[model samples]
Target: MRAGWTWLAAPELWPGRRTAGEVVLALVLGIMAAGSEELLGGEGPRLAVVGIAAVVLSLLRRRMPGTVLAVTAALTPLLSGFAPLLMLVGWSAGRRIVGAGRALAMFSVAFVLFAGVTLQDSWSQQAPMTRLLLTTLYFLATTVVPGLASRYWTQRRTLLHALQERNAQLLWERELVAGQARLRERQRIAQDMHDSLGHQLALISVHTGALEVDPELTPRQREAVGVLRGASVTAMHELREVVGILRDGVEAPAPVDDSGLVGRGTAGIVGLVESARTAGNTVELRSAGEERPLAAAADHAAYRIVQEALTNAYKHAPGASISVELRYEPDSFVVEIVSAAAPAPAPGEVVSGGQGLTGLRERARLVGGMVHAGPADGGGFRVAGVLPYGVVEAAPFVAAEDDFRQQSPKAATVNGLPPMDWTVSARELAGGKERSRAGGIAMGCGIGVALVLVLVVAGGFALAFLVGSMSQGMIDPGEYESVKIGSGEDVVRDRLPNGDTITLMGLDGKGPKEPEGSECLVLMSSDVGDSFETEPVFRFCFKGGKLIEKKSYEVSR
Candidate 1:
């Protein structure tokens, strides 16, 4: 019982189960169609046959939808009992057929066939032109319109799914970026500690070693100095190991300034600018307001921001002039670097990991600061940072990264990177383009359907009016009487008009019952006119290639 319930609850849990469900649905629809036909006075046996055929065709609709649609249309007039099945095939065709051109061709073929069959069956019935028009409209409404609508619905669902998947992928990538940013920040911290604390330990080791060899020191004093030297060396080794763990097995480069004062504070800026100039890059430094002391973390963050900006300028802009500005406001310190744009670099001239700006932003965030980097007003790049004088308690790294991700895109940088003008990946751009294309296709389909509907309605009305004005199928009273009973079918047809006009009046089916096992033809009289209050019609029954009965009747307009 549990297994049965599981299968019922989720039929698609196993292969072929969904197809089985579809087949069951088709069977139910077929049964309904057959029952409906019987209720509407159709022959039970014939309707059952049609229903079975409809079921078979519906099952193949997915694979050969266009072919199935055409076949169903051809059978429509003969099997009016299976109209529901016809509509199902049409809708399936619209959904399965790819591309607008192919769909249009398939629908057009089906529509024409349906219209032709309907006209052939009803041409001799009362008000044939009007009936034809109404039937055509009904066919479009039930079959064509539903099909087009189904196609549109399917497209919308597919586009929505693509957008959802793309959004999910972007969210995953954002989390990955945040993780990478946190790791890089930790490595930066490790490098800073190694430069400063490792240098001090080395100095201590050197001094203790010197004291151990001093001739003036007593034996106990020399022994104490030897122990201190050994401890300092061990501490240095441990520091290296910790730094290695932080850097994830990557070795940190030696500091440029051997004294370890290059990225300490404002003093470091002076040396950094001089070094850039020495490296054949034009550089200028400006300072404003009263110089004040800053928290250790903030000071280091400030120096690093300047160093990264200057390095980027030198690498990317090559010959462009760079300006580093410092403002020591009462509440905060601001550091801004602007570099003019230069000629494009030669192939392979510059290789960048694209992580420098991200690292700067992370460094600033740890010290309660924000960094903004983007294009400047006059064809250049600018990186500006605002740091608090007093260090604030740092937020969790993941939380801080999340805050950056939620920042407005209008800002100069997002998630520690520059604006997306140049940073947007090709894959992201392609996704955007795909969404736009999908929207355009959906709009075009809607417009095309509306246009087709309008054209069909207008044309159908015009044709009905033209057909009503003609009298090509009307017979005079004398010709109707000349068609005697027992006449050969050919002789009777030759005596009658070229065409029949049962469209002058409506049929009630209350006339004399048709002869058993015989075919009948109904025609209009020539006395009928547009202004007539009543119409005269002639009915002829034929059996075994001979006319068996002839009758005349009158119907109110």
Candidate 2:
């Protein structure tokens, strides 16, 4: 099996060329473990050299990590931090075999061992016990922290590579599909225009030829005929261009490629407003917060989101008073387009029934961004999107689209299908960047959560130590004080000082005498009594070498 899968599983071909580095790290860890015996306990050099030899061989972990790991583990028993060496070797081997998850498990074992060693080292010291415990814990934590971190990094890199691979695959697939779609669209356009415009042109030509044959026509009539002929020729040329678009498909004559970090953001969105205003629609453009750099993907997505929103406003609700807003929030950028319903445009006034909103939604989804469109409480359409600040690579698939309106007279954005120059490309919008940044933020937060859990566990252990060991002869210094308090006027008379809560009791997985807790439950009761009384008593105590009881209060109907 090893020989058969040798090529498939070769470590040299692992992503990012990291096999060599991993091997070196494994070896270093092994040698360190080997040398620790001499430095820590003044042991003989024989065991040390053996360890070094094992380590030297352990460098092969990347290619044959399991074998190297086994050898090192068997050789390093007497060395200091031997567990760490074993763990690193495990990771070196495991990461090559399983994934980051298994490597992490190996790292966890090493981390626990380091903590145990630190705890043992910190005992019998002159410092206060609490101080000793804390220092020891932190020291152990720091010792193991690197291992834990490496585990995460290994996982993170592996996951990232997986993401990139998936992304690459997706991108390849999208391009392939986009190519086919462009071709299909071209074909559809060709069929449509040929059937419609082609017949019209043929008719126009026949009409002009008839006029030419009619010699009895007067000079004015002849001039009119000439005008008709000219119009027909012009129409034919226009139709031919349309057909050319379909036949030529997305292969634009000119090429374009560049990250267009140079494009306008606010100004670009503003243009849509100006165009709308010129068309008799009322618009207000509002900007907020300082502008920041965004990657190409986000910038373009933002622009498209706004453009489509504005287009929808004009097409479906012409003359609507529209407000366009761009705001910078804590972790994201925001774009909002709001407009009043100007009454559905008289059929002729509206060019489209409503495809803009649908289109924008699709755009948002691509970046894992979101778009919310609905009628406002005040009356009008509201389109809002939250996006990331940066990471919008200025290149998008639309760059290659021939159908995209040319940004300038002399140049245009190019797409996949043998299109124009690669010099200029569109950037993704701010919202896309925001979402991606948000995803990264979430990842950091997740790791932080793990750290928090570690701290919590350490704290609980600290607390347990305090509880079990700290005490005066009769009482702890900071025990809860006995005090007098009053209840609020609205307090229910039927209830006691404590609420009626239920605790769920099951046999718990352990046998009948299990020492654990089951789930909890809650219960409520109506007014059992209308008045409060301080008559009930229940208490027990055992701190001062004696038992004590205290009176309690209750309310009864």
Query: For each candidate, what is the lDDT?
Result: 0.74, 0.54
Please list all clashing residue pairs in model 1, or write none if there are none: 127-503, 128-503
TM-score of each: 0.44, 0.37
Prediction-by-prediction clash tally: 2, 48
Q: What digit string (tens of lDDT, one per residue) describes model 1 on residues 1-557?
A: 75743444342254477657877878977887677777878885778786798777767777678999998888877676567777788778878898989999988898788888878856546457766676677678767876887798778768766754565556556757876897899899898989999999999999999889999999878877776786687569758866886889454432344566633466688877877775557898999999998887778778878988987887788878899999998888999999988766634668788998998888887787889999999898999998888867553323645654443333333345443232344234334556767866877677568746766876787677657644645678888887789999998877765443434335446468888998877677777554566667778888999999988887665
lDDT, residue 437, candidate 1: 77
Stretches > 4 Å off in candidate 2: 1-10, 13-31, 40-48, 81-83, 99-189, 250-557
Model 2 Cα shift for residue 409 (angstroms): 22
lDDT (10s digit) by residue, model 2, range 249-289 = 53222112143322234446665566566556788988888
> Model 2 TM-score?
0.37
C-alpha positional error of residue 487 in candidate 1 after TM-score superposition, expressed in Å: 32
Considering every candidate listed, which one attains the maximal lDDT? 1
